[model samples]
Target: MKNLFIPHFIYWSLFMTSKENYHKVSILLSIYKVEDYLEECLDSLLNQSYHNLEIVCVDNGSPDNCGKILQKYAKKDSRIKIVTLKENRMLCGGRNAGLDHATGDFVCFVDPDDWVEKDHIKAMVDAILTKKDSLGNPYNLVLNRNAVSFMILADGSLKKMYDFGETSGEKTLNDVNLNVREDTEVPMWGRLYRKSFLDAHPDIRFLEGMNTDNIPYTFKLLAHMKRFYVIKGEENATYWRRLITPEGAITPVVLWKNMEIPICFDNLFDYLKKHHLAKNLRIPYHWFFTICFPRHKDQPRYYLRFKELMKKMEDTVKSSDVYKQEDRNLCDLLLYAPDFFNFMERYFTPVPVRISRSRIKLFGFIPFWYIRHKERKVYYDLFKIPLFKRVKTDDKEILYLFHFLPIWTRQTDRQ
Candidate 1:
C-alpha cells in the first residue's frame, strides 16, 4: 500500500539485472559407482568462494550408494542439484544429463573421484572475467595451468602432477596455437567455457564410447573456438586430479583402443580440408602418430592394426585434394612401407632395457645408453614409458619420457 511508485520497481529490477553480469558457474559432475569419492568432490565445489555456482551431479544409475550421497548434499545446499538416472549411460550420457539442467554463465566439469583446491573456482572465474574480446565481450573459454594430478602410492602417500612455481598469465587463441600445434594439454576439466558457446555448437559433444574421445574433441574444440583465455592458476590454487582409481573404476582393456584411429582423424581432417585448414591440423596428425600412438607398440599385433589404419589414412590423403606427401610424411611412410616407420619408431623410441635384478641390485638407475636393441628383439624392446616425439629446441633434441623423469636428452651425454 505504501511506496507504489514506478521508480521503486525500476530500481529493484536494475539491481537484479546488474548481478547477472558477474558469473554463475555451473559444474557438471558425472558419477557411476563413485560413492566413496562423490561426497568429497561435492564438498570441494560447494565450499568454493565463488559462491554463485550451480553444481549438477548426475548419478548415472550407479548401483552403489552414490545417488543417496548426492541427495544428501542437495538437502544441505540449494546450490547442489542432483539428477538420478535409472540406468547406466556411461560418460557421455552422464554429461548430457547434467547439461540439460545447467543454468549458468560459465560451465566446467569435475569428476567424482577428483577434488579441487579451496580457491580453484574463484581463481578461474576471476581470470576469465579479467579478459575481454575486441568487441569488449568477455572471453568465451579459459584454460587452467595450475592443475595437479594426484596418485596414491603403495605406502598411502600422495603425488602431485606438476609443481607450480612460475607466474603465467592470460592466453589468447594465438597463445594456444603455439602449444596446441605441439600437442598441449587437452583434458576436459581445469578450464571454463561459456555456456552459450556450448549451446551454439551441438555437434561438439564428446565422442561416445571412444577411449581417446578427448583426443578428437580437444583438438576440434580449439579449432572451432574464436575467442579464448587462460586463467593463471599456477600462482594460485589448482584442481587436484585423481590419477588412481578403485577396482570397479579400473581402465577397461581396450582393443587397439580402437585400431580405427585413422578413421578418427578423418572427421577432423575433413573439417580442416573443408575450411582450407591444410596447414592448421598437421601438428594434430603429428600428435597422434608420434606423440600418442608410438607407445602402443607393446604388442606386435598393435603394429599390424596401425599398419591397416595408416594404409586407410594414406589412401585418404593421397586421394584427397588437401593433405600433401611432404606435410604428412609420417603417415606417408607408414602408408607406403609400414615396416619402415615401425623401424624408425623402434630405433628412436627404444625401450628402456630390462636388466637382471642383479643389475638393479648393483645400479639404482639403468643407463639407457647401454640399451642397444637389435634384430627381432627390437619388436619387444620398448621404453617402459612410451617416448614422446623428439622435439628440437634451438639446436638441441629433446626426448620426453615419463612424467616423473620428463626430459631425456639425446645428445652425447646428459648432465
Candidate 2:
C-alpha cells in the first residue's frame, strides 16, 4: 500500500508540471474611459494566433460603458480576467494593477485605444523561444512592430513600419532600401517583453502623476534586457491610432504644471547616474531642457525652477566626462534665445552668447535651399546619416544653414 501511494503522488506532480509549461503568453491591458475603441482592441487581442494567452484587464474607474464591455468579454472567454479599481487610478496605477495579476512566461501591454496584428503574439513568442545569443542563453527579446496612423476615424487604415536606418523624421514605409537600426528604443505599446525580466526589476514602476510618459519606465526596462528584436516583415503588426483632431485624446499638460517636468528630469538624471548610465542619458536630458523647460516660462515660479534645473544639469554634465560637450552645445543654444533665457534667469544666472538671430538665420538657409534643390541630397544628407554622426560633426553647421532658409524665404514670399 505504501509503494502504491508513492507512485500515485509522483504521477500527480508530473501532471501539474506539464500543465504549467503549456501556457506561453499573457496580454496585460490597462483600460480606462476608452469605450469608443475598446471593442476593436479586445477583438484584435482575442483573435491572436497564439491561443495560450491569459488576458488580464485592469479597469481604473471608467465612468463609461467600459465596465459592461469588459464584463461581457470576461463572461464569454474563460482566459479573460477583469480587475475593477474602486477609484479612478491613473495610467501607472492601472498598469501596476495589471502587472500584479499577470502570470505568464511573456507579457505584452496593449493600450485599449490601440490594436495589434493577428500574428503579433505568435511572431514575438517564436522569436523569444527559438532565438539564441552569444552565450547560448535564450535572447530576452523585446519585439516591436509598426503602428497604423489613423486617429479618430477607424476607416483610414494606415499601416506604416518604422525603418530605424533612415534618419529620424525621413523614413517612411515606402522606402525599399531602408537600413533599419537594430537597437532603437521606442514607446511601450510597440513591444512584447519577457515576464521574468520584469519580475527581476520590481522597482521599475511608472510615475503616478506623470503625463503617462512610458519612455522613462520603458528605457529602464529595456536597459536591463539582454537583446532587442525589431520585427519587420509582412507581420504588419500594432496599429497606433494617431488622434489628429483637437478634441481627440489630448496629451496631459503636466509639463506645463509648476515644477513637475524639472523634478521628473532631475529624478531621471539621478537614476541614470546611480546606475552608471549617465552617457546614454544625455539625449533625453537635452530633449527635456530644450523642449519641456521652455514651456514653463509662461509661469513665473516654474520659469525660475527651469533655470535652476538647467544650472543643475549644466553643473552635473560639466563634472562628468560623458556629457560635457553635448551639454555645453545644448546650453549654448538655450542662451542664444535671449528672451527665453532672460525669463529663465529670474531665478538663476544667465549664460552669455554673442551671436544674434539675424546672423545665425543667414547661415541657416543655405543648406536648406541647397538640400531641397534635389531629392537625392534630401534623402542622403537628411535621412541616410545617423543621428550621432550629425550631432557630433559639421552637421550643426548644416542645421544652422537650414534654419535660415525659412526666414529668408518668408521675406521673399512676403515680397
TM-score of each model, paired residue for residue: 0.67, 0.65
The lowest-lDDT stretch of 10 consecutive residues in candidate 1 is 372-381
Alpha carbon deviation, residue 317, candidate 2 (Å): 2.0
Residue pairs in clash, model 1: 351-382, 351-383
| Residue-level error in angstroms, candidate 2, position 74 | 0.2
* Model 2 Cα lDDT, one tens digit per residue, 1-415: 9899999999978865763356467787777888978888888889987777888988888899999999999998988889999887677778888888899998878778877778777777776676665456665555554545454545555434333221221122112112112332344565677788888889877776544546466656544553455565554355454443324443435554445566666666667667876544342555554555556535656545545656656655666554546566665544344665564564245645432221122365543211222211221133322121111122221322332232111112221
Predicted model with the maximum TM-score: 1
- lDDT accuracy of residue 207 in candidate 1: 50
lDDT of 1: 0.63
- For lDDT, the strongest prediction is 1
Model 1: per-residue lDDT, tens digit, 141-248? 777767766776556577765643233544444554444532246366677788888888767665554434444555666666655665554466677887553333
Give model 2's TM-score versus the native structure.
0.65
